[model samples]
Target: MTANPRGPNAVDRHVGSRIRLRRQLLNLSQEKLGEELGVTFQQVQKYERGTNRVGAGRLWNLARVLDVPVSFFYDGVNEGAGQPGFSEGDQTPIVDDFIQSADGVALAQAFARIKDSKVRRRILELVRTLAAEEAEATATEAAS
Candidate 1:
């Protein structure tokens, strides 16, 4: 079946998000990925934004270039109710959105380079604390 007329469907968006996330994690620019795929960077942007649907062969090529299994693109998809999309309660999209951002990618890469498990745990705790404090401040402001 074809996607919705309005735009790419949920599955397409999810797959595109995965592609973008993997590309960023590997520190590859859209231009670089496009070169590897023999496509222009604008084409890569369309794929990343789900403005264009990826063909099966293209998906296979992307998997190979990204050094991941083909199934990676469908990793967090929900197959419930005979529909292919993310569930309302699924956190994958939220996490993917964060990890797709510039700051998120930088933070993730820096964190990954830390070899000490205890240090990693401590960093996680610190981030959690900071987030909680920020949330509290936001709530206080909202109450004002």
Candidate 2:
């Protein structure tokens, strides 16, 4: 396939996002990850943004440093017939973006620690309600 003139292709972007997610999950900074990989932090940023394509060897090193298999980078990628990006039905990109954030990670960690299923369900309902209310308020304000 021809290189995308606009930038890295979908697969690269997906891989970069996964790299970022794994790094964040381990509470590792881009600088720290870069140090481990013997690259500059800016290079790490490029990798995470998909501005740079990672080679096979580099990807293997990343997997080792991140404590995940190389396949983890392609976990959410869709390989439908000729399609080379995320599947239409997948909400992984959005969810991944959220989970990569500090608040999202914090909330997820805290929620996961709750052993009571009922309490967890209640918390989920509460969050859903709050989100619904916020959406409604935003819609109302937009219509005004």
User: All models: lDDT?
Assistant: 0.86, 0.85
**Alpha-carbon TM-score of each model against the true structure:** 0.82, 0.84
Q: Per-residue alpha-carbon lDDT of model 1 for 1-144, expressed as tens digits?
A: 954556676677778888998998888999999999999999999999888889999999999999999999989776651254534355455666678788998998899999999999999999999999999999999999
Off by over 4 Å in 1: 1-7, 81-93
lDDT of 2 at 129: 100
- For model 2, residues 5-73, the per-residue Cα lDDT tens digits are 556776787788889988888889999999999999999999988889999999999999999999999
Candidate 1 lDDT (Cα, whole model)?
A: 0.86
Residue 3, candidate 1: alpha-carbon lDDT: 42
Q: Best by TM-score, which number?
A: 2
Q: Candidate 1, 110: how far from true, in Å?
A: 1.6
